[model samples]
Target: MYVVKSPLPDADLKTVADALQGALVDLVDLALVAKQVHWNVVGPRFRSVHLQLDEVVASARTHSDTVAERASALGVSPDGRAATVAASSGISSVPAGWVKDSDAVGALADALGTVITRMRQRIASTAEPDPVSQDIFIAVTADLEKHHWMFQAENA
Candidate 1:
C-alpha cells in the first residue's frame, strides 16, 4: 500500500505543483490533438488513425488524473484548473479554422514537442517531492514521442 507523505518542503511543494500543472496542461493538449486527428483524419489510413487517436486521448486523460492525484499526495493542490492550464500551458493552440487531415498530424507533433520541452525543463529544476512525478513525465514523453513519430511517418 502507498502511504502519503505530509509536511513536504514548501519549496518542493511549489516545484511539484508547477510540474504537475505543466504535465496536466500538456495532457489536455494531448487530448485536443487526439480529438483533432480523430475528426480530421482522411485517406487510406483514416480508420487506423481514428482508432489510435481515441486510444491516445484515453491514455492522456489517465495520466492527467495520476499527475493531479500526485500533487494532492504531496500536500499541494492540483494546478489543473481550466484558467491556469490555458494560461500557462506551453502547447501551441490549434488554429480556429478547419485543419487538413494530413496537416493535423504535424500540428500534434508540434504540440508534443512543446510538452516534452516543458517537462524536460521541469525535470531539470525539480529537486524533490517525489521521483514518481519525474518518472511519469518521462513515460509520458516516451509515449508522446512514439505517437508523434507514427504520425510523422504517416505524414511522409
Candidate 2:
C-alpha cells in the first residue's frame, strides 16, 4: 500500500501483509511465552522440557523475523511492538508463576497448533493473489507443523 512497485497489486500485497503481520505478532508472543515456560517449568522432566522449550522459543523468534522481513519487503511495516503484539496476537495467554513441565508442554503445543491452523489459513488466503507470499506461508507452515509435532511429543 505504501507505493510498492511490485507485480502483485497493492490490494493483494495488503492482504498478504495483514496475514504476515498477524502471524508475526503471534510468533513473537509465542516466543516469549515459550521462554517463560522454559524458565519456570518444574518436575521430573525439567531438563528435557526446559531445553525443548528453548528450541521452541528459538524457532518462534526465527520464524517471526522471517515473517516480518517478508512484510517489510512487500512495503508494509511489520508491527512488532509489544503493545501491537499483545493486542493482535492470536495465541492464548500464558499462565503466570511456576508451570508444571507437563502443563507447559501441553500449553505450548496448543499455542503452536493454533498458530499452525492460522498459518494454513494465511497460506490459502495468499494462494490466489500472491503465490510468492503463499509460498512464504507454506514454508512457515512446514516449520510450525514440525515444531507442533515436537511439542506434542513432549506430552506423550
Candidate 3:
C-alpha cells in the first residue's frame, strides 16, 4: 500500500522507481567499499589514499541519502539494507584483507567507473519519466567521476 501517492503515471513511475532503486544500491555499496579500503589501505601512499577514500565515502553517503529521499518522494520505498545492496549492487565485491595503497587506488577507480557507467544509464532512463530523478543521477555521476579521476591519478 503506497501511503504517499506518486504524481507520475503508473508506467512512468515504474521506470523512475527502477532507476532510483538501482542508483540507491550502487551508492550504498560504493560507500561501504570505500570505507573498507580506508580501513585497510597500506604502503607509501597510505596516508593520502586513506584520506581520499574518506572523501569518496562522504560523497557516496550524501548522494545515497538524496537518492533514497527522491525515491520516497515519488512513493517508492528505498531499500538500503545490506542484503539488498549486496544482491543488487553493480559494483564488484571488495577484497577481504589488507590492501596495498596502489591496489586500493585501482580498486576504487574501478568501482567508481562501474557506478558512473550505471548512473549514466539511470540518468537516461529517468530523463523523460522523471527529470528530477535524472538530474539527481547526473549530479551523482559528476561527483563520482571526480573521485574516479583522483583515484586514477593516484597510481599515475
Candidate 4:
C-alpha cells in the first residue's frame, strides 16, 4: 500500500484495491482476447466482426486503466503487468490458431458475460464498505454489458 491518506480505512482500501486489481486483470485479459479474435476472425462476417472487436478491446483497455487508477488513488499499488494479469485473471485463454467468426463471437460473449457477473459481485461487495468503488464497478459492468450484447448479437 502507498502512503496517500484517504477517508476509507486501510483495511477497506486494501479490500477494495484487491477487488479492483482482480477486475483490472480480467479487463486486461479481455482486451487481449478481443484483439486475438480481431486478428484471426474469418468467414463472411469477418470484416464486421474484426472491426467490431476493436471496440471491445478499446473498452476493456479503458476500463482496466480506470480500475488501476482507482486502486492507485486509494494508495494501492496497481499491478497490471502481463504476468500478473495471466496469473490473476479469470478469463480463459484464447486459442492460438485462427478462429472462425462464430467461434470468436461466442467465446468473447461468454468471457464478457463472465466478467460482468464478477463485476456485479464486486459492486455488491463494495457497496457498504465503499460506495465510490461500487460506482466504479457499476459503470464498468454497464459498459461490459453493452459490449456483451453487441458481441452476442454477432452470433445470432
Candidate 5:
C-alpha cells in the first residue's frame, strides 16, 4: 500500500511514518517472542535468559506502543493488531520448539538490529515533509540499536 493518503505535499513525513509502522510491527512480534522465550526457555541458561527475555519483552512493548502512537500522530492508521503484525512483520518467526536454547536470545537481538537499520533508512527518506517525525524515527532507531547491542552482549 501507499505510505500516505495522497502525497502529503512532502515525501519525507510519509516515509518516516511508514518506517514507524514497519518498526511497530517488528517490535510487536519481537516482544511477543521475548515473552514466549521468557516463559519457555529451559536448559543451562534458564534463569538468566528468562530474566533477560523479560527485560527485552518490556522494551519491545514500549517501542511498539510508541511507534503506533507516532503513526497515529501523523494521521496514519497503525496496524496494531497481533495478526496484522504477524502477517506483515519482516522478521522471520521461530516456531515453538524450533528455537534453539542458545539461539533464542540472539535471534531477537538480530531482529532488533535489522529493524533499526531499516528504520534509519526510512528516516532519511522522509527528510523533506517533517523534521519532527524524522527526529522521532531517529530516536526510536537509536533505542532499538542500543537494545540490539545489549542483547548481543548479553547473549554472548
Candidate 6:
C-alpha cells in the first residue's frame, strides 16, 4: 500500500502529516467561507468588501494547493474533501443568508483570526519534524494575517 515513501522517520512524519492535513482543511474551508460571503455581502461597502473577499479566496486557494502538494511530496495523502473540511476545519461557519457588508467583514476577520492561530500552532509543531512544512505554514500564516488585518481595519 505504500507507493511513495517519506524520508522522515515515522514519528516525525506523523507530526508533520497531522499539521499539513489540519492546514489543508482550514485553507479549503477558508476559501469556501470567503466566497460565500463575497456572494451575499450587501450594504454601502458591498463593492469593496466583495472585492476584498475575492482576495482572501485567492490566497486560501493558492495556499491550499501548496499545502496539499507538500503533503503529497512527503508521502501523506491530503484530504481536501468537503466532508473532511467541514469536520476538521478550525474556522467558524458563515451565516446562511444575505450578510451585511460590515458583518461580512467582521465574520471574515474572526475566521482569519482562528485560522492564523491554528497555523501558528502547526508552524511550531512542524519546526523540528519538518522545517520545509514549517516554512510553508509560516508563509501561509503571514498571508492570512495580512487578510485578517485588512478585514479588521474595515470596521475601524
Residues 1-156, model 4: lDDT tens digits: 337666798788777987899899999999998998898889888998888899999999999999988887887778999999888888888889899889989999999998998898899888888998899999999999998999888778
TM-score of model 4 (CA atoms): 0.95
Rank by TM-score, highest first.
Answer: 6, 3, 4, 2, 1, 5
lDDT of each candidate versus the true structure:
0.73, 0.87, 0.95, 0.89, 0.74, 0.96
Candidate 2 lDDT over 20-97, as tens digits, reads: 888899889989889988889999999998998898888889989988888877778888999998898888998789
Q: Against the true structure, what is each candidate's TM-score?
A: 0.83, 0.93, 0.98, 0.95, 0.81, 0.98
Worst 10 residues of 4 by lDDT: 1-10
User: What RMSD value applies to candidate 4?
Assistant: 1.5
lDDT of 4: 0.89
Better structure of 2 and 3 per TM-score: 3
lDDT tens digits by residue: candidate 6, 1-156: 767899999999999999999999999999999999999999999999999999999999999999999999999999999999999998989889999999999999999999999999999899899999999999999999999999999999
Cα lDDT over the full model 5: 0.74
Model 2 lowest lDDT segment of ten: 1-10
Misplaced by over 4 Å in model 3 are none
Error of 3 at 154 (Å): 1.1
Better of 1 and 3 by lDDT: 3
Provide the lowest-lDDT 10-residue window in model 1: 1-10
Off by over 4 Å in 6: none
Taking the tens digit of each residue's C-alpha lDDT, what string does model 5 give over 42-126? 7787787778778777878887788788787667888879788878887766667645557877777777766777777767766
* lDDT tens readout by residue for model 3, 9-83: 999999999999999999999999999999999999889899999999999999999999999998899999999
lDDT of 6 at 22: 97
For model 3, name the residue pairs that clash: none
Off by over 4 Å in 5: 1-13, 98-100
Q: Compute the lDDT for candidate 6.
A: 0.96
Q: TM-score for model 5?
A: 0.81
Clashing pairs in 5: 12-126
